[model samples]
Target: MTQTEKYIWLLNTIHRSRGRGLSLKEISDKWRDYMAKEKPLDRATFNRWKAAIELQFKVDIKCNKSGGYRYYIANPEDIEDDKVSKWLLDSVSMGTTLMGNLDIKDRILLEQIPSGLVHLAPIVAAMKSNHRLQITYRGFGSYFSSTFPISPLCVKLYKNRWYVVGQCFYREKWQEMIYGLDRIEEARVLDETFKYPEDFNAENFFEGTLGVSLYEKVKIETIRIRVEYPHAHYVKTLPIHPSQKLIVDENGEYAEFDITVRPTEEFFMEMLRGGALIEVLSPDYVVEQMKGWVNDLYNVYNRK
Candidate 1:
């Protein structure tokens, strides 16, 4: 393991031993095999690492100085609720796990994100420097490709596909848009650096929106969905949205959930994912839209 990876490994190790903290000896012993060099983890180095870990990841590894000098993550519950830090911790843990289980690679069946990944590095590099990215993109439903200059802002991964959101000139006017990484044919970082918007928040861009579909004129409204039986259990466990509430729960036979989101194509597709198990209950337009889709499916599948 590298220096950063070793720190992550140590963080993961201590996080696992949350209730009962781990002694320095135990940490060193557990991390022995993961070391890049044969050098022992001395007090000075470990102290430096502890400080660095806290600074880098915003994770506090407090030592029971008065007790056994055992170290543990302070307020471990905070990490679980913290999206960014928690995700980082989980990602590092996965990497370490995969590294250890390399021999069982054949046994692990993993779904892969297909296409347009080659431009990630260049795009990220451009974003880091606030430079523009000249990308040759080929969006869906078009026979031809187009080259354009886009100010690299942020990237998000959803449903196993990577999407880059940025401000770019398109159609006729300059507008902020999302482009799938797979759609980018070629990307190059330009020397001209653009000012990264101070007011624009990346997280807020996708706020109140489901999936990565960006529509200029999105109709944001409350949508109620009726889920029946066992499928209701799925929604209960993994809710469709943060606004989702158990408005009506009757006899465990069915349940109603409310989610306030833009009923975009992606939103409709998410509802459609339930097939016949889910039904749009409110807002006549959305219901009619769902009915229209069901009718189309019925026509396709209903062969007499």
Candidate 2:
């Protein structure tokens, strides 16, 4: 096993020991004996391993001048099931919503995950190794299929679901496909390796837009609205976005705010939801579009 894995096992052991502590000498003796039987580990290697674990895992295995070392369990007597059983159940239930649907085995596996993570390690390893992946994917229309040679760029999490934004070698285009890690039938790293495009930065790619949707060019539109109190309390507590700014208060009665956005469908709906409480008062096109949508909805309800 790697030093990191050994360190984790060692930490687990310290937590399991259930005592005042084990001294550095005691730990070294035990670890040396254990490693000697398995392979070979030097004293320096073990010290480096311990230091790495302390730095990376935020787990400080303290050593006293008296040569006593002890583990500080975040919470003692905290049984896994007793402490986090409800969380595990909720995670599995929520996983279904994120993954759409799953089979019997997948449901069981998902329920077993304490944190509800869909086993990202395998997928991440495949990506890092530059190996082609075999994935079961559902497209935009809920159509499902198994494909063997997808080149992954990065893995992304959106609203609890996991997606791999990558290049589809078979289709010859870059696409972001959501993989239900719980429903992943099988994954095999192919011998053939592919390089991610030097310029493709996932963060840079999806910087804007409310969700995962991507667009070539985005136009920023300034939206001005008037809100009156104490109903304005709603807006005061919740500004639309970080770009929102209070313009002025006319006679200290109502205030105006200017917000800049890409004018997405979600943002448009939010504006409409404000109703008469908020008036859209800028960028003639936005005003016209809102009126058009309102009229369309009105006609739909008014029709015989």
Candidate 3:
């Protein structure tokens, strides 16, 4: 294993042993076996790695002396809760798995995302310098494209597509707008800069909502879904939204989840993902809206 991979493995090992920390011998044996090496991990190298890990990741690896000198990560939950750290770890894990299976790379099928990655760097550069961007954009259904100046606010990725949220002078007033990266025909970072809002949080703007569709008039409401088992298992493991809460879980039957979010079109598609296994059950209007969707589907497939 590479030196970097070794450090990550140690961090992961110590992080996993949260309740009862691992001993030096236990960690060394596991590392040796994992790499299929003849020699076990040495103490001096391990100590160097411990220090390096602390320096690079700012993660403290402390030992419990009274508990047989076992090592554990200090405040393990911090890294777990950090989105950037979690993403880095997960990405590295995937890379390691794929790297080892290069022989069967042809057999591995991956999802195809839109080709808008080229504009990502330029957009990020503008965001970093607090500069404005002049972008030539064409919406999905529109026949014409428009070139406009936008003050970079934040960038988001959803459904394998990237989007940039920016402040633009629209309808004679300044307002925030979301534009898909794919929709951008041409984007250039302008020399002019605009002051970024100090109180603006990119995460908060997208929170309590699913996907990228944003509506100014949409009301945030509590949506309750009755997802039958089989589908319930999947929903429980991977929640539809961050605000998902299990209202009722009937073993071997069904589960009901309460999610507080803006009922956007993308959110509607999520509810329909499970087919008959899912049912929307709350707020008379939301239920009626879902019923209309079902009726529309029924009329299309079962036309008289």
Candidate 4:
């Protein structure tokens, strides 16, 4: 068999093994026995072939993640459906599209997400069942509480992280809540099914908010941001928010933009991460909130 054929066979074998990592000895033994009557593979040749597979895929195939030297792709299944597999592979290959200008390490980590999808299955199952899930979430600013009897609407990916948007019983209304799959310690599908409101539209649910939390009391307001030079170049192509409108200043050598969204904590944290490269210039409340957050950060750091 050619290298491509061998690689396909290898991927199939690994996928058949399920979540259990397969050992090199086991793989080599099986390959040798299975192809003995046909194109026999020697031990040394098999090892080289394995190395080539790992290098081509950029996966830690030989890494000792499962106690011993086991071959495991980031995702167990090398999906055979040409269309679906191509789209999935393309999503990871085109990381910049999913995560804007990610660094090498960030890109590699993002690619590892498919493996983590193993955890997302339960959330999906829960949603399908019309049951609730118990999750511990720590957002960018705050952390606390379990979402009891949360009416799960859908699961989505933003910036390569999986979040389940659902209704919080505590809040007494449909609210867009984002819980990272990795942070979700435990999830249970309740026997009682929730009656998801027919009027609830997942797409428009959090349309006004920057992240997930939406406050009904406040309306989505326009806020302007100024990005200092050099980084301004990054902003031109990759915007901070979809609502952003860019305005270039010839003499200032900087980029200024405005976005209309509910200024939630998550929204403020987005600007905080941008540091000095970007500054929130408008909406007195937003500017004050940013200052308050900076003061809180100073208090925490100054003591230590």
Best by TM-score: 1
User: What is the C-alpha local distance difference test score of candidate 4?
Assistant: 0.68
Error of 4 at 282 (Å): 1.5
Cα lDDT of model 1 overall? 0.85
1-304 in candidate 4: lDDT tens per residue?
4565566567556656765767777876777665655444556776676677666654335445647766665544345444444444454435423333444554454244533455578778888777777665544455674545566788767666777777775556555565666566566677777777788777677676776565878788899888888877787787767678876554357778888888888887888787878888889988998889888988998999
How do the predictions measure up, each by TM-score? 0.87, 0.49, 0.83, 0.53
RMSD to the true structure for each prediction, in A, is 2.8, 11.8, 3.3, 13.1
In model 1, the runs with Cα more than 4 Å from the true position are 33-42, 75-78, 246-252
TM-score of 4: 0.53
- The candidate that achieves the highest lDDT relative to the unseen native structure: 3
Model 4: runs farther than 4 Å from truth?
A: 1-89, 92-116, 125-149, 171-178, 188-194, 249-252, 295-304
lDDT of each: 0.85, 0.62, 0.87, 0.68
Pairs of residues clashing in candidate 4: none
Tens-digit lDDT string for candidate 1 (212-304): 886649777899999999899999998887668888987568999899888888887888899989999989998998888888878888885
Clash totals for all candidate models? 0, 0, 0, 0
Among all windows of 10 consecutive residues in model 3, the one with the lowest summed lDDT is 91-100
